[model samples]
Target: MPQTLFDKLWAPHVVADLGDDWALLHVDRVLLHDMSGARALTEVGERGYSLARPDLVFATPDHAVSSAPGRSSATFAGGARPIERLRQRVRETGIRLFDLGQPGHGIVHVMAPELAIVLPGTTLVCGDSHTCTNGGVGALAFGIGASELTHVLATQTLMQRRPRTMRLTFTGTLPPGVTAKDMILAAIGQLGTAGGTGFAVEYAGEAVRALPLEARLTLCNLSIEMGAKMGFCAPDDVTFAYLKGRRFAPTGAAWDAAVAAWRTLRSDDGAVFDREVAIDAGTIAPQITWGTSPEQVAPVTANVPYPAGPADQAALDYIGLAAGQALIGTPVDWVFIGSCTNSRLSDLRDAAAVLRGRKVAPHVTAWVVPGSETVKREAEAEGLHAQFLEAGFEWREPGCALCVCVNGESVPAGKRSVSTSNRNFVGRQGTGARTHLASPAMAAAAALAGAIVDVRSY
Candidate 1:
């Protein structure tokens, strides 16, 4: 009778068992963005289907909006149509949209948590893969395809196969300069990208519990890179503290009641998982992706690995790195610090600590884009933005800048960039661009050194 955290969150939302390990699960929260939300909404409207719960759906314009200062929806010509269409569709559907320049507007994943639109024990779905980022607060969140987005919009429910449960427990103490980004990166390198296929992973153990809520979100944001659609950490005091007094979170007596119920959102002691993996926190160092895949990673002190096969060789060729080459001292042309993966206020603080009195190298173009307007305002309030600008980093407006490269921001072709974004896939930042994934601090260090260097040394 024991239930895992995923089971506890999932069972209550089951509207029906659709058989074949699939179920019709009620969706408590739905997020939409300009890139796909407009199309999905248009589809539903054309079909004459009404939204089952328009109030539960929140839309934003992160994907197609420019992050440049004084930017407007029209700033990115390629994305202007989708932004306009999303604005029009949301008006027709009566869905609440956090429009550009609005207080609540931001990247769907970032603003959702910042505004407390996602909460413990809820089921959230977004059109983007990093929707799993909301799971840090204990939500059963996942991404949906175009059809699935329309289905959820029409019925406020989705048909999904049950995923096996896996627990990744981080034991021991995190080494100096190690971070949640490093922790997850090390796990992916150890287990490979396909390690968590068909499973919903729950992060636990000492190190995971000790992570700040924002860091926990960063940890969960990369779950998709490991082939898992869903990942989460159980609700604890840390989770509760993070949600208190937020815009969408409960208030007064309702807040007290919500906390009481949320306390039971953990897995039962006797609960069984399909698989469990233990990672030593002490063994993990600052991690950087060496190749196209998130799994192609090594510690900052490590060298480019010898190719194990053609796949490895091909990755090396694409990244323009030779086997046995040292990752340290590799020339970096650009440094970007932002993304749903690591763009919260705390992430900015981490990078600022490294760039406080240092200037960026003359040849390295560096940028620091906050994840949301709220984060941008808060960082500015604390003077973090000034420090970055003083250190030769561009203080960019928020919206996935340089991460997806769809909003008029990208590393130029053939440039090498040290980025804090989640994935380092070929051309992820721009055509023929090579991306090295690292923590915000690591990216800052690269910006200062004009090359990949160990953050601990910086």
Candidate 2:
């Protein structure tokens, strides 16, 4: 039987068919963060169950940690509780933890791939919803809830229903400034937020193949926004090269075996997917989210759509946009260029490139947070920080800064901002703050113009 890339990776993980479309899937890696993971671990201890495989689990403090340089657990107001709790849980389970100030410590999604902790043709699970970000490395990664986390903790396996496979092939070449962020946002705009429900998406075709490893990560990071259970790109030389020298990657003869195995992990030529969509890369432009939902997107040059229903009207109201209003020249009070979705070194470099020799508008408060300490170090080494600092953007330490309101970093209420984070739901950045989602370059353009402007204009 011919099989899709998804089938090639997933079928091997199924331990047993439990009927009703469910299967017992063996999970290769389990990642945990401070906020939800601490609680899940506590529940497992309370239930008197031993961890089935503590060596396979990894822990980090990301979500609730302060991204402020010189920050301690105590430096972030009200952050000590979760950090201490995570440390305690990690100690109890005897699992490895990437603690604050350590080189390996970072946003779970970012660290996993950079360290080669997430390998191709494996299953990875995390308590965070954006766990799908790890799927960028060609793993069958997905997010699980608290109860599900407890189950995985106790047994290193999960019960999940098989998902239909969807293939989205991007043809032609992408124009400069039309990034992976733009590509995913454009797909969501055309397909709506719920379009990929009940499906795992396999991104393919010329454009996808041509993407750098980091950009491929950006594409898969937003798969959740399109309602995908997970998303992945088939492994090839680019994938192997990125993983080759990483700490956790297999070495020597083991490396040869791993690469040989990965080469066969792609879909057979005659394989068929349950659903298929094709996108012309040339047609995609720099995208901006107009309403709260990621699907409510428009090209930077386009006007906001006129509301077609009460739901649309409500989204417009919450986001402070009027029907048919233009997004260009719309005033912005803040600009954030960071998140697990787009906070890697390449993302920072792209934003810094736009800010070089240009000052941010006096009224806009702009920030650039690195995704990991390693990325921060690399960017600073390459003088990327100086460009941002000279352009009036704050260069912060790594963590999920300003992406969610949990760490007390927030955009003030009634303010409008351009951000590169994944979600723009109401109150995602802070209470009552209106978020306009865009690529890092687009965010940089907005920071300079003090209003939404096309990056192509810069």
Candidate 3:
């Protein structure tokens, strides 16, 4: 009996089959953020519903917090109203909260794996789409809507259908400047934004195996953009090693038991996937988005996509960009390299690799916000913080910061920012602000040149 990793994971969590693309699925973990708690709790109050597995639920306020370095003021347009409301909701529900300034405070996705709350073979649910980020740890994790989140909060079971499976396999080695971010962006570009709809994607091959834990998260984090409901990697020695000493991981005899359990979580030899996409790491370069959709991407030295197939005419016009024109050397107003997608400690190190001894272009406003205080501390200890500052980039505190514009942080209107954060939808960074998503290393190169320079040559 051959089973794909997706099938192996999906089988354990299935509760019932309910025709019409829905199945009763059991949840192993429920992650929530400040904004989501407000709506979910208010719904719980209105509907008189109670949490199914209250002990497994946790809350944090990272999404809307100010990443203003050492600034205490949570100043945004709402001025902490959202934060207070979320705090009130979490308190009312009696759920454990990492809170704003706590050691575990950070993007829900980044914080989960670091705490070891996301173990192999578990099913994790959250209100944020990037929850797929946890799939790096061999878990089935992804975002749900507010309504679905409320349902999960009250009922640890979800009405979800098993998705089709897609396996992304890559062999050989990645070229320098090419990263998991680029690999994922390339996957999304190849499949287009709608490629993974109603599917769970498992990454395999020599390239995927070579990636570090943080890099795998970057690959899985964007599964949503490809329209996948879940993304995961199979558990292996590398996975066990990465989890063995994490904050919330098992200890002593329990730790031994946990490791034993994790060791068995791999695809059966005959496992099957509904679909698969194979890529070569050598073919992938540092990728960057040229338009609103994550699918509108190209290699660093490549030109913007022309009207291929059916494309967004308006989006192509909005940036005032044309097909076949190179993005390299195009002047950029800002460069941001922080987000759940690329704000981890390793991400900073990668950026610092390119930023060392090189100054940011005078015309570019550069910012680097660590994903968590833990990441911040580690970066500073390693002097990566000093490297960023010396390169003229703002070495700021940890939080969602400009990634969500949930805080006061925002790019001025009409400014084009080369950001490492996920999603470059229209005005996603701010009102009328334009964003281009790329890997952190590519971001550092762009910051140095103050434009969209191809990193293949950097």
Candidate 4:
């Protein structure tokens, strides 16, 4: 069979095929974050339905919580109360939750794979778009709307249409300063936000294999931005090694068996894909968005592109950025690093390397957040926290603070922020907050320079 990775993952879950395109798919894992779970649980209760397999589901408090530096709690002290009530609900339901203040508490995407909850030949769903982030472990992972979330909560199955298969092949080595974030941002810019609609993208070639598992997660995290329902990579040794010691990982003989099964998760030689895209790693520059869409991006060393003839002038005017201005020296009001997309300890270490001895610019309000409680503790033990604070950055507790304005932790409107989070859509960070998405390194560079600047030189 000329099957792609997506085909391999999707075929196993098919329960029945409906005329035209829909099918009933059996879901193996239902992963939901704090806020989305609460909403879905409420909706499920409103309709009087019970979860069929609570044990197969996992919930965590990440998005609405604060991942601020030095914060020991999972639920923020001053944040949304309803969110915590929901985390309690997950626990009350006997759902295994990485609750606030727990060792593994952090972004669900980062936490799931680290615990080995997302393994080969599994189907995972979450309410968050970046659920695709887990695809790095060779699982079929995707996001769903609140309605689909409620359905999954009610009955561990979902009605879905199979997505087309797309293969992205990367060759050569990335430059020293480029990170996974740069690769994904470049992908989004190349394909446009809607490019991968109805497709599942499988990343391959030397460039992908060269990335660390966490970096691969960052690469798959933005698959939704390209309109994919799901995305994944092949399971390999890097995935197994990172998963070996996590709390929920398989142990002893089970671990050996699991690894043995995972070895066959990749596309076989001569396997075919519905679509293919090729990228040369050497030419890709450090990337950042200039406008409302993730696709409206330019190289860090390039200028904000000018739109031709007639276009969304509203977005252009709102950013207060005239056409053709170089992004390298553009001033910024805030800088944020630490989101589900790039909040791992490695991400913190990369940013810290840039700010090690340099002070943050006087006018920049900068913050660093670790993805999980374990990540928070690890970074603190290594003095990454001290370096950031010494640089005049505000060290916050662990939660998804400012990753979005969900918890009132927003950058004040009209202020431009260079962020490490995924989306830069209008009002995504906060209403009217001009968001320029970049890698942790680039965000760190912006914080120190008080503007969007190429991180390579630093």
Among these predictions, the greatest lDDT belongs to: 1
Candidate 2 residue lDDT tens string, 1-458? 88999998888998899999899999999999988889989988899888889989988888887888788877786779988998998888899999887887888899999989999998999988789888777889999899999999998899999999999899999999999999999999988889998899999989999999989999999999999969999988999999999988999999999999999988889899999999999999999999888999999999989987988889999988887778898999999999988899999988988876999999999999898888889899999999999999998888887998688799999899899999899899999999999999999999999999999977
Positional deviation of 452 in candidate 3, in angstroms?
A: 1.2
Mark the 10 consecutive residues where model 4 has the least summed lDDT: 66-75
> Which 10-residue window of candidate 2 scores lowest in summed lDDT?
69-78
lDDT of 1 by residue, 192-259 (tens): 89998889999999999999999999999999999999999998999999999999999999999999
Question: How many steric clashes does model 4 contain?
Answer: 13
Model 4 CA lDDT for position 430: 85
Residue-level lDDT tens digits of model 3 in 1-458: 77788766777887887878677889989998876867787797789987777678877777667777666535554647767877787778787778766788878888899888898989999988889999999999989999998888888888987788888888789998799999999999999889999889999988998999989999999888888868888878888888888888889999899778777777777678888789999889889998888998888888877776445666776566777888897788899999899999999999999965999999899999998778888899999999999999998877787777877789889888999988888878988888889999889999999999877677
The lDDT of model 1 is: 0.93
Error of 3 at 132 (Å): 0.8
Superposition error at 92 for model 3 (Å): 2.4
Residue pairs with colliding backbones in model 3 are 2-270, 2-271, 3-271, 23-160
TM-score of 4: 0.95
Q: Per-residue alpha-carbon lDDT of model 4 for 157-180, expressed as tens digits?
A: 899987778998888899899988
Residue 201 alpha-carbon offset, candidate 3, angstroms: 0.8
Candidate 4, RMSD to the unseen true structure = 2.1
Off by over 4 Å in 2: none
Clashes of each: 0, 0, 4, 13
Ranking 2 against 3 by TM-score, winner: 2
